[model samples]
Target chain A: MSTTARRSRLHRQEHLTALAFVALPVIGFLLFTLYPMLFSVYASFTNWNGLTAPVFSGFDNYIAMVQDPYFLESMYNTFFLMLGIPIGLVISLALALAMNRKMRGSTFFRTIYYVPVISSIAAVAILWQWAFNGDFGLINQILALVGIDGPNWLQDTATVKPALIIMAIWKGLGFSMLLYLAALQSVPRHLYEAAALDGAGAWKQFRHITVPMVRPVTFFLVVTSVIGGSQVFVEINIMTPTGGPEFSSATIVWYIWQKAFDNLQMGYASAMSIVLGLMVFLITFIQFRLNRRNQFSID
Target chain B: MSSQRVLPSPPPLKPERNLPDRTSSRAASHTKTRTRPSNSERKHRLGNLIVTIVLSLGAVVMVAPLLWTFSTSLKTREGVFALPPQWIPDPFVWENYLRIWSAGPLLTGIQNSLIVACTVTIVGTLFSALAAFAFAKMRMPFKNVVFLSLLAALMVPFPTLMIPQFTMFASIGWVDTLLPLIVPFIFGNIIMIFFLRQYLNSVPDSIIEAARIDGASFLQIFFRLIFPIIKPAIAAQFILWFMAVWNDYLAPIIYLNSPEVQTLQLVIANFNAQYAIQTDYPLIMAASFVALLPVLIVFIVFQRQIIESIALTGSKG
Candidate 1:
């Protein structure tokens, strides 16, 4: 064969090999992710029960979502659960700050903090369920030691959200703490030395230097945490299988699960899922825009 | 970087007027001191001591639940809910741990979880690395578009597709089997591919070209050269993906209904439901502790790589 013919043959082989390399992931993505995503959007506009043929019904499922009290309650519960994000961020940031200094046994403390992050959600939920038990829980027992009667935490509608939020914050604290510590260590030490030389106290140095330097990481944690918090399921599912004493802790995802599987309302659940997906996308987009604007202003 | 530029530098000479400023300067000097100890040094030491104490207290709080889980697992039923809540089990029942085998499908759950986790990790990692190699090094048509679409898949959370995916799997008769859990992952995970691609971007083209000149096929170069170079990152991602699959509850619950085929997480959930109402706290705690043992061991063994992965992702963001 001529040299040019051989070169072209080699090029064809390279292209074929590259396609072969990527073929599995491409196929998997199409079948599992892409097709399902499109089908879900289409499924939202129809009436199907997983057995019978789907009947086209425009705007019906979407309208049903507005009227569904359970859907509204779950939306409320989901947003309410997200209240833990700021609290978690603050606590983790404080822990990161405390551990940022070169102290003895920092590694040990970090490992302690990170243990929960590594533990399975089912296990954590079970442990916290015991911890939040009204009569025999650790929290209540501790409260009783201080002359206070702790309410039925997991059973009470009023305290159920708070109970779940505390567990979430506890589980997620180490992750953000580690991220902040990474960001903290990356901050130029000379800046701190310069500030210290100019008589900046601990609080001032922290406020002026530490906070501003870690803004990017803080933004990252906020966006990712909110996205994660909105999807709270196993914890609530395990702790309150019946949605926590009259659907008080029924999150949006849990509601979707119930609707889709328990009730077998595939079309309606698809509608809710589509709405949720849009909400997540919008939130992430807005955060991106806001961060970009903040960075611009800082510059 | 912009924040650094915006901050005003300290003045060369400033008149110290406030007591706090003097104290701050004294503390700074104390930090700098190597030889003679001063009064400010003592104060600084005291401050460090206070911070250390507070952090240690926080660490205890962080560890209290896991410790309680272990302690409760070893306790008898009565000791579980005893007034004043025993920090250590009185009788230290080894039976609770042993009872997990018969009380529920814990052993089956563990075996199923290991099968799914290990198969998915190995298969997913290999495919992801191959696809990443192609994306990072190989020339191909529509490469950027395909890669971009793959990255776009990250935005599509599982819940959005749960219904249709479930329907699809059920129609194919993959539901109620471990196929639904392991098959999709065997093709490769998007996040794993993305991470490996990022790692491979730093690799030089000249090295691959030299390998090619030495009569190495693309597959050979990838396996012989790129794999070893990115093994650490692949291992980190492997451990993470393993934990995700091991901890996964929703997919397993939705897909696998049989007690024998269910993953460890589902079994624990089932165990909790069956026993929580009866208040079998020791049994529940024992099962949970057992379920968490593998993950905890993996985390401890690969803690550095795990933390580095977190740090890497955070910095990339």
Candidate 2:
């Protein structure tokens, strides 16, 4: 066969394979995800409980969310949830840096750190609820050894979000550690050698070489952490029902969940989703722009 | 080995030539060769040790809750809230586990969750892989545009789509059945397909051409050739899907209202409301522990594969 004819035949075969590949997900995307998304946008413009016919109400749902105390409280709680990002980042970075060194039981320790990430959220939340119990929880019991009193973690508004933040950090740190560890591993051996030859110490080497090399990973981690942090829902919902004492830990997602399900205000809930989505989008956009300006990539 | 052996000679060169008496020479060499332990070196080693300990401790803390739950389950109601909480039960109450087994709804929830989780994994995986294979290996028209649009669509959070998805099922009278719970996964998943596509792309095209020349059809080639190569990716996706379906609260909560069809998570959530209130903490803990065992097993078995899959996918992207 002529080469041109053979090339055209191969091209046709590749085209067929791609069609077969995309068929299922494209259909699903249209049916399950896309259609629902479009429908919710329409639903947001209406005033209706899920049971009744949705009456077009223009911007009333959006207007209501603006003044809604629950919305404001939920928004506040989201910021509190974001406390996990910094706490997690510091611990994870410390961890990644530490584990980057040659050490005993290195693989085992890495696996141990990652195990929590794989465990189910429900199991983790339930376990923490027990540990955070005011009267006989293990944490309080431990604190008592030092002659310090422990507060009612889940019951008190002041400490509820903080307690949840601690849990978030524990669960989330492993993932960021993985990202940072990968970046650390990618750092060139020659850079360290060069630094050592120049009489630069370990600190100087890390500052001048490792930090610059890992900046892209750090930026990616920060952006993702914000995105994940803002969507915190399950912990609050499971650990402290009724959104903790006086709804103190009532994150936006939990409220959205409640409004849509418990309150049957789908339209209003959709508005909340839109706002949260926009907030996440804006934060992500700004981070990307900053990263571009900084020209951080070593690639 | 010889090259590394030769590498350290320069550092020890000056001190070794100065010694005459054996004992004095040994002491002299020790003094001269012991370079200053820089702050960074100490910090670096200390930091590594600290991280290992802290991570290990964190893992212990992570499992502490599960341990407590397990302990409570094995204890009597009296021991559930004991002061300075007992670390273990003396007799190891095998009865709590047995009681959980005997509990009718609990069993139903287990069966339902398993069915849903397994179904979601198998069907979701196959279809998603098929879609991903096409996306990765095939060169159909408008490929980049189509794939980009799909990625963009990921931004639409499920909360925004819940009402309509629920209503669509309800109008079709599919709300009460497991169909609502399991059917949507039949199509390719966004994350899974994307991942599979990434993996499939790394597969050398020459292999596919070799299969093509053997006179295999598309289905044959996919099943016989590509499937084995992507086993690791499939295993990773399977574990992820299992967790997703098993831990899923929102979808199952919306879809399955009947006690008979309720999943384990929904059952656990409803334990207080329906099964028991003023609850037996020991029993609840026992039930919760039982609920967690499978997920932990999945993680243990597939952790390496999962990590490899992530590294593989992340690199391709």
Candidate 3:
């Protein structure tokens, strides 16, 4: 064979091998995920009780969601959970900064914080349920020490979401901390040194050097936390069986679950699911746009 | 991904070399005459000490709930809810651990969880790997469209499909069986497939060319060459899928109706509510802790591999 022919044959063979590697995942995604997603969009328009065949009912479920008190309550509850994202990001960054120093037992601290990340949400929920139990719980005991009586946390309308938020922070902080720690480590020492040489104080150095360097990481965490926060189901499902007092803690996913499972409102549930997906996607899209703007300024 | 953020090493400061300033002569003279720590050094030392103490205390706070769960499981019923919530369960009720064996339907639930998790992990990894390989290497037309579509799959939000999937499974009369839990594993998971595909794309094209020159088929190249190289990626996906399926509650709740098909999550959720008459709080907590053992074991065993893979993958993600 000519040299050119030999090289071309080898190149073709490599391309063929590449082709083989990507085949199965493509087919699977088409069959499972994409198909189901498309299926969901179509299903949202139909009146189906999961058992019966889906019937065409144009815009009814969507129209119903506009007026549905339960859906509105769930939306409110979802935004309530989202409040934790900013608080969580700041607290996690603070924790990460504290740990980033060459302190003794740093690994021990990282591992300690990360324990909750791996823990089952069900386990965390049950544990929190006990801790937030109205009468004999630990939070109440602590409250009593401070000369304040605590309400039935999970059952009280005012306290339920806050209690869940506290648990969410406790459950969530470790993962965010790990992400921040990674971001913090990536920051160059020269930047800090340059700031120090310029007579910048520690706070100023952190504000100018550390924060800008880790902006991408911060953006990533905030976006993801919002996504995860909106789908807050297992925590509520386990901790507050009735979805908290007066349905205050029933977030979007949890509400959809109740509709589909308890009320057998499959059509309505599917519509709610679409709305939730759009909300998450929109938030993420906004975040990415905002991230690009931040990156542009930083660069 | 965090590991990639290596800071540039600053030049080491020598006391004499960098002390060319007017302030240094006075500072040097003051320090040279004294063995006692200066106020600034004392403050620095104090600051360091404070940070160390605070960080460690934060660690304790972070881990306290886990410790609480563990220690409380060892306590007697009275001790479990004691007013001052005993940090130390003196004369620990060893029966709490022992009674878990006698706990109702726990053994069955454990078996069910293990079967589902194992099946999900093994099958999910295989399917995902196969799909990932196809996406990474196969030369089909319209590949990017398919790949982008697959990426889009990650955003569908899982709950959106739960009702429909349940309905679909119910139509096939698979809802009550382990089929709903296991069948999807055969189809493949989007997240795992994406992870594998990304890692496989990083594998150099030259190795596959070498295999193909010897007249190896696509399947052979995949099984022998591609698979071996991506073991780290596979192990990473394995741990993730294992944890996910093991901890999954929503699916099992929706699909598995019978006691025979119940997952560990469902069992734990219903442990106090269902088996309340038979076992008390300590026993329930003990069983709960026992249920957590497999996850802990998996975490400890693959913790290093998982963490490194996450660090690597998180950068690209």
Candidate 4:
């Protein structure tokens, strides 16, 4: 064969091999991810009960969701749970800033903070449930020492959401802190040196040099935490099996799980899922846009 | 021999050089001015002390729950609820650990969880690494489009597909089996692929070309050349994936209904329900701690690699 023809033949062979490399994952994606995503969207418009054929009842599930008090409560709880996001950002950012300096035992401190992030959600929920127990729990025992009374945390309507939020912030703290630390390390040392030469104090250096440089990492963390926070399930499921008093702790994802499996209302659950998914997508989109605008302003 | 001659030096050593340079540069700048011991230096030392104290307090708070769990596991039922809860059990009971063995299907749960998590991590990492190798090093038509569309999978939340996926798995009679959990993931995990691909991007293409010229096939090149280079990235991803699968509650609860096949998390949930009402705190804590053990071990062993992978995600993004 001519040199050109030989090269073309080699290219064809390489292309075929490349196709083989990706074949399994593409098939898996189509079956497990892509197909189900599309099917669930279709299911949302129906009234299937996971047993019979889904009858097309256009927008009924969506409409019912709007009027459904339980669904709305779950949505409210989900957003309320997201209250941890800002708190987590501030706390983790503070922890990250503190640990960013070349200090003694930073590694040990980082590991301790990260323990909860690595632990099973079931383990965390069970441990926290014990701590939040009304009568003989850790929190109440501490309150007693302070000469104050403590209400049942998971059992009370008002405290259940707060309990969940606190657990979430604790669980998520290490991850966000570590991400921020990474961003902190990557900040050019020269920038800090330059700032110091110009008489910038430590706080001023952190506020000016550190914050702006890590904004993208901060954006990433916010987007992920918001997405994750809204999906809180195992914690509530383990802590309060029945979604707590008056469903105060029923997050959107938790409700979706209950509706689908427990209530056998697959169609209704799919509708809620789509709505929740869209909300997440919209938030992520907005974050991306905001980040892009910030980048432009910086430039 | 020709391949070895054509190949450049390994890339892992570069980071070692970069590290010392970073520290020395900062040190050099710090020593640039040495007039007198300034007030700011004292203030900075004071600041460091404050940070240390604050961080130590936070660390204690972070660890207190786990320590409490372990402590409670060693206590009797009454000891768990004691006012000003005992930091140490007077007579530490080992019965809680022993009881978990005979307690409702805990052993089975551990066995099943180990099977599923181990299989998924080993197989999933292999497949993801293979696909990532192709994406990173090989010339393929529609590569960008294919990879980008696969990334779209990340946007679709788990709940959105839970119902139809359950139906699909049910139709195939995979509902109660571990197939639903293990099979889909063994093909490839997108997140793992994404990370490995990022790590692999730094690897030089010339080495791969040299290997190809020396008559190594695609699979051989991947296993021989690329796999060793990216082993650290794979180790990090393996532990993370193992933690995810081991800690997974929702999927196992949805799929595995039988006591014989349930995972550790499912059993722990059921155990908590059965015992919490009965106030069997020791048994509950023991079970929770047992379920947490493997992940804790993995995290402690591979902490640096895991942190690096996380850091890699932040920096690359």
Candidate 5:
């Protein structure tokens, strides 16, 4: 074959080969994600139980969803859990900054802090269930020592969200801190040195050099946290199986699962699922736009 | 779809780009640092000492719960409810550890988990890497469109699809088996694909071009050349994917109703529900801890790499 002709043949072969390589995942996505998503969108508008064929009811489930107090309350609970993210991020950044210094035992401490992150949620949730036991649990015992009596944490409407928040922060600290630590490491040392030479104080150097460098990590953390946070089910399921005292700790995913699997309200649950997806996607989109504006101003 | 949220935005603010005074100022700072070395050295030492002490206390809080779980796993029933709440399980009962194997389906749970995690990660990773290699280096028609569409899959949360997916699996009679867990995942993980593709982008095209010119086929080039180059990235991603699969709870609970088929998470959760009513705290704690041991071991062994990979990707993510 002529060289040009052979080159053209190779190019055609590469195209086919690449498509063949990618075909599996594309097939998987179609079968699992896209197909299921389209099914869910249709299911949301129907009134079918899992056993029966769907009968289209035209926005009835979505209408009922807006008026459903349980749905609203669970969503609020999910949002309340979100309060932990900023608190966790702040503490994580501080921890990472502290660890970034020339200090001994940093590796030891990193591992120590990361223990909770690596722990399975089911295991940790079970552990925390015991820790928050009304009388003899770890938290109350410690509180009693300080002359402050702790409530039945997981059982109280007032304290249940806080309890979940505290645990969420503890579990997530290491992961975000590790990310922040990585972000801090990447800020060129010369940049910090330069900032210092320019009469930028420690706080100023931190504001300028550290914050922007870690903003991407922070943005990444918040976005992931929201997505993870929105689907907060395992901990709630394990810790407060009845969805906390008076349904205070019930999250959207927990509610959806209960409706579909337990109550057999498949169509309604599917509608709620659609709403949750929209909310997550919308929030993420807003974050990206906000982030872009921040980027514009910084530049 | 969970993987799509974090955009692989390269770290935006490289100071040298916008900070025109940075390099020259750094040189001046270096000379100035030499004149006041002792003064700054003392401050650094003091700062390190303070940070060390503060960090230690924080580490205690971080680790206390796991230590507490371990301690509780060794305690007698009443010892758990003792007024002081023993920090150490004095006169430890080693029986809970022994008894956990017989309690419910803990053994089978681990077996099922291992079967699922191993199958999904081992098989899934190969497909992910191949797709990644194709996406990264190979010439294909409409390549970017295909890649972006796959990425767009990440936007759809699992919760959104769980019911339909449940019905889909059920329609095929795959429910109550590990196949539901393993089959859907064996295709490839988009996140892993995205990361591996990013890792491969750093390699020059000349290498792949030279291999191609030598008449190496695509699969051969991937196995002999690309795979070795991307092995470290694959290793890190493999560990992450393995941990994710091993620790999965939601989907397993949705499908596996029979204890024999349940993953370790479900088994432990069942233990929590059943044993808690009887106040079998130690037994529950023991099972939960055992459920955690595999991932704990993996994390400790691969701590540096896992941490670094997550950090590297998080910034880019």
Candidate 6:
């Protein structure tokens, strides 16, 4: 009876010790993330100037959000930027395939491609800002060599989104290619040989074996790219200081940030943030369902 | 051989030197290529040559802009707009390097960034490892429940929380200071905790149990046994985390108003904003390159580890 009681006491001690080990992070989650999330939900209905108490304004912020032209424009521009996702994926996959082929100096190419990915976004944006200068730009200067005069990229709304998309593809290519290369490595070579023996050509083999095999990585990339694309701010901040002529380059996060800090419209910004959160949640959920269906059919 | 039956996971754990062994064997196969007259072998050789040429061209596209950035930093401010733009600056003005120190709070920004990133990463990593250990190994009440809840917090998105968080910090008067950036992070990063937990789960429970039987306390075991075993994982996560904090702009801009309190990226961004209009392109380029240099150096030194860690994250996820 005494030994049993001692054993129970020792177990309690272990439990408490483990809890102590985890206390800081658990408490931190509460104080930082959970508290702010709860506050955000409450603050969404108020008209807070951030200096004074948030006075509850009900659905006014939500109602105003729908009619806000800046919000709408920023929302449209954000999604438009995501057009780079498919472009980046296709380019990365092709690059991965090329690198996967029997080759020398593959590591050299891998490092070269990943350089842009590792560079700071702010720095890259600043460099690109100069590169997009109408007259003296690197891009236009190169285009001049080909007898083509490139249009001013960032100043005009028409070309601004495309310019951002091209930059995004260039920056993201190496990382995605690396992921795809790793995935390609794991695919059984015998499957390719089997397909070849069955008279399947290179394109047919790629379509049948390679594409399906890399689907998980594709899904991973797509989900992350969308999450990242939704929060695009630094480039827009650096390259197009006023949000690209007509707010053409402003993303949703950039809009929310401007509203909250610049204008001190914390409540209205909170409402928009809640909407963005839901949009992210909904999009991720839908993608998850789509992925499940794809997996089911493949199985 | 890649033909060996693949491990069910950790696919790219294949050594980076996987190619060198094959190259070493090429001396034996030297005769085969020399004697090769077959159409298939010829096609294969041609394909490799074509790929090499194309990838080299791609590499040029990848590197030219960075090279341009470095070159631009050395040009005269007026030379930046010079027609038939100089790929290599004519005079190679070495003055921007000296001028950039006075251009903004570049030195202060570097110091602030170093303090915040170094403290947060060094301390936060320890706390995260501790949390990961507790969740992965120890028997605690509501363990998975607590772990899952912390994971859920990650989904809230910072924009949704930045307002309330800002208010909370402002009430404490942490605005215009580095505390807002450092404090929340030092509590522990959920992503780091998650990855470390995934790493720890691979460790055999038997060894830990054996240690426990020897009467070593949990903290003792963690310090002597766990930390070293997971040192590689910790280092990978540390370097990535440090780079992230250094490159971060959005959070620092939101909190730090004064130039002195701002982080490195923010200071360079301010230079870009303030000086680009003044047509001080060389100074701005110089400052920007300085901000990028630290991470760029880290990447070059730990290139293999960083790439593998990233590749591991993708497959493991």
Highest-TM-score candidate: 4
Whole-model alpha-carbon lDDT for candidate 4: 0.87
Residue B136 local lDDT, model 1: 92
Tell me the tens digit of each residue's lDDT in model 5 across A40-115. Answer: 9999999979888989999999999989999999999999999999999999999999998755788899899888
Q: Tell me each candidate's TM-score.
A: 0.93, 0.87, 0.88, 0.96, 0.94, 0.94
Give the alpha carbon lDDT tens digit for every residue of A1-299 in model 4. 69989999998899899888887788889988999989999999999999999999999999999999999999999898888899999999999989976657888998999999999999899999988889877778778889889999989998999888888898989999988988887788789889999999989998888889999889889888888877889998899889889999988999999999999999999999999889889988999999999989878
Q: Which 10-residue window of candidate 4 chain B scores lowest in summed lDDT?
A: B13-22
Best by lDDT: 5
DockQ-derived CAPRI band for the predicted complex in model 6? medium
Top of the candidates by DockQ? 4
Taking the tens digit of each residue's C-alpha lDDT, what string does model 1 give over B1-317?
12222222223111111112324544665567645467866766787798899998888888887888888899988898788878779999999999989999999999999999999999989999999999999988899999999888877778998899899889889899998889888999888888888878777677787777778788878876878777878888899999999999888889988898989999998889999878888999999999999999999998978977877777667
Give each model's whole-structure lDDT: 0.87, 0.75, 0.75, 0.87, 0.88, 0.87
lDDT of 6 by residue, A1-299 (tens): 99999988888988998998899999899999998888999999999999999999999999999899999999999999999999999989999999877668998899999988989999999988888878888889989989899989999989999999988888999999999988887787789989999999999999999999989989989888888888899999889878888898999999999999999999999999998888877778888999999999889
Order the candidate numbers by lDDT, best to worst: 5, 6, 1, 4, 3, 2
- What lDDT does candidate 6 reach at residue A237? 86
Structural RMSD, model 3: 7.3
Kindly state the fnat score of candidate 6: 0.70
Residue B123, candidate 4: Cα error in Å is 1.3
Task: State the lDDT at A5 in candidate 2.
Answer: 100
The runs of at least 3 residues in candidate 6 whose Cα sits more than 4 Å from the true structure, single-residue gaps closed, are: A1-6, B1-38
Per-residue alpha-carbon lDDT of candidate 4 for residues B88-157, written as tens digits (9 for 90 to 100): 9857999889999898899899899999998988988888888898888878899999999899888888
Native-referenced Cα lDDT, model 3: 0.75
Per-candidate DockQ values are: 0.50, 0.43, 0.45, 0.69, 0.60, 0.64
Q: Report the number of clashing residue pairs per model.
A: 0, 1, 18, 0, 1, 0
Count clashing pairs, candidate 3.
18
Ordered list by TM-score, greatest first: 4, 6, 5, 1, 3, 2
